[model samples]
Target: MLIFWKPRLALLAVPKTGTTALENALASSADAAIVNPPGLKHCTVRKYRRDLSGFFEQKGKRPLSLVAVMREPVDWLGSWYRYRGRDALAGQENSTAGMTFDAFVQAYLQDNPPACAKVGSQAAFLEGGVDHLFRYDRPSDLIDFLRDRLGQPVEVGRANVSPDGDLTLSRQTRAALETGRGADFELWSAL
Candidate 1:
């Protein structure tokens, strides 16, 4: 997460959305940047409203507008599967090594997904609401907005990207994912 005090805007770092690149580009201009410990780096809007909003908005006397980037739901899941399957995570319990995309997705739709499919939902992360949202597939929308909001040109390069891989899923599994995680699709579509 990043806060631009002058703009009274906060950027929530949504996972699998190139947030790291955006943060790297915008950090210098931000009044503060939370970049360590995955829990804090990827703090949800709900957590912010419950824990930190008061400190920044009430005590600071500024009501900050929140912003985030959301990816197409299926693509987001694909990224998660690919990321966990990387060689670095080969022996880890959360690794997706030797797993088919369909199997990974099936586990993800479970009420209690296995570690490999435990990536949290984008919809749940932003359930508290946000003032602005941009689509991961639409880079210019975010870049242009940041340029204006930060008063400078903004550039983002790929960071923490997963290696190319097949993300194929059977039709039945696809249907299950769409049904199980509908909110993610809805939220991304809104962007």
Candidate 2:
């Protein structure tokens, strides 16, 4: 997450949405940057509103506007699947090493997903607290918004990309995900 005090803006780091690259690019100019301890780095909108919003308003005399990015729900799940399948996580309980993308996504749609498919929903992360939302597939739009707000160009390169592979979900699995994660699909569609 990156905060620009002058702009009274906070960029919430939605996972797998190229936030790392944005954080890296804006760190020098940001009034503050939270980039360690995954919990803090990926603080959700609810947490920020509950914990930091009051502090910012008290100290800065105004509330910070929040910005976040959302990826297409299925692609987001695919990234999680591919990420956990990396060699580094092989044999770990959280590893998706031998699992097919369809299996991984089916696990994700479970009421209680296993570690490998427990990736949180973007809609849940940004629920009710975003002043601006960007589509993950549209980098230029985000960059342009940042430039306008910060009075400087904002550049972000890809970071933390999941391993490359073709990920095809079975029709049944896709239908289940769409039904089970309706909020995610709705939010992404609205974006």
Candidate 3:
């Protein structure tokens, strides 16, 4: 997460949404940057509302406007599938090695998904809503927001990209995901 004190803006780092690149690009300008401990780096809206919001209000003498980025649900899951498929997690329970994208997404639609497919819902992360939200597919919108808010030229490159592959889901699995994760689809569609 990156906090720009002067702008009174807090950028919430939603996972797999190119936040690392944003952090790297804006770290020097941010009043505070939390880039360590994955949990803190990817602090969600709920956590911010419950914890950091009051703190920021006290410290900054005003409520901070929260901003976040979200990706399409299926592509987000595909990133998780490919990420866990990397050789580094080969034998781990969280590894998606040898699994098809369809199987990975099916696991994700489960009431209780296994570690490999338990990437949290973006809608849940931003359930409280934010002052600004950007779609990952349209990064230029985010860049424009950052440039205007920060009063500086902001540039972000791709970071933490998962393995490359054709991640096609089976028709049945796709249907299940769409039905099971309706909130995610709705949120993405609204964005």
Candidate 4:
């Protein structure tokens, strides 16, 4: 859950990667702080990255060492789709809940939907602008990496909600996301 990291640590919350659970655990167990953005529903890297240094300066906190969790694009998008699909159908009893796989893939690549707003283009994330990247699928390594960076031990287990549904992607969708979104996939692979 929570591990001290350097002086100021920013968990660049990439969405749908168990971020809420991780954030909850950290807030409860450690001296973790949340960025309080005025009049905004949520924070995105795009909203804050360019302005981060000043934000830190205003808070009288040093520049933070950043960490983020990434998931394999295929699995990540699969979970995203399922979660969104459920929400899309939440109030409608007989709605066609979600797009076809191909449509989802197209929208995922071309639209860059708001649901994934904070996640930037793969090239940017892969270029190491952040201090470290961790795999969401393999959280133990993420915890260990943070521990090493923080020079402290961290407990990296347990969750408030059991991840509700198993994620599944059609083979065609997987192949396309891997081939077309290879950069994002590779970023996680490198970590």
Highest lDDT scorer: 3
**lDDT digits (tens) for residues 104-183 of candidate 1:** 99999989989999999999998978999888888999888988887888878778998777999999999888888989
* RMSD of candidates 1 onward, in order: 1.0, 1.2, 1.2, 4.9
Query: TM-score for model 2?
Result: 0.96
Per-residue lDDT, model 2, residue 178, is: 90
lDDT of 3 by residue, 1-191 (tens): 99998888999999988998899899999999999899888899999888887887785568889999999999988888889999999999999999999988888878898988888899899998999999999999999999998999998987889988679887888889889889989999998
Q: Name the runs in model 2 displaced over 4 angstroms.
A: none
Model 4, residue 84: distance off in Å is 1.0
Q: How does each model score on lDDT?
A: 0.89, 0.89, 0.90, 0.56
lDDT of 2 by residue, 114-166 (tens): 99888989889988759999998988999999999999987787788799766
lDDT of 3: 0.90
- For candidate 3, the per-residue lDDT at 143 reads 97
Which parts of model 1 have CA positions greater than 4 angstroms off?
A: none
What's the lDDT for residue 120 in model 3? 84
> At residue 88, what lDDT does model 1 achieve?
96
Q: Global CA lDDT of candidate 2, please?
A: 0.89
How do the candidates rank by lDDT, highest first?
A: 3, 1, 2, 4
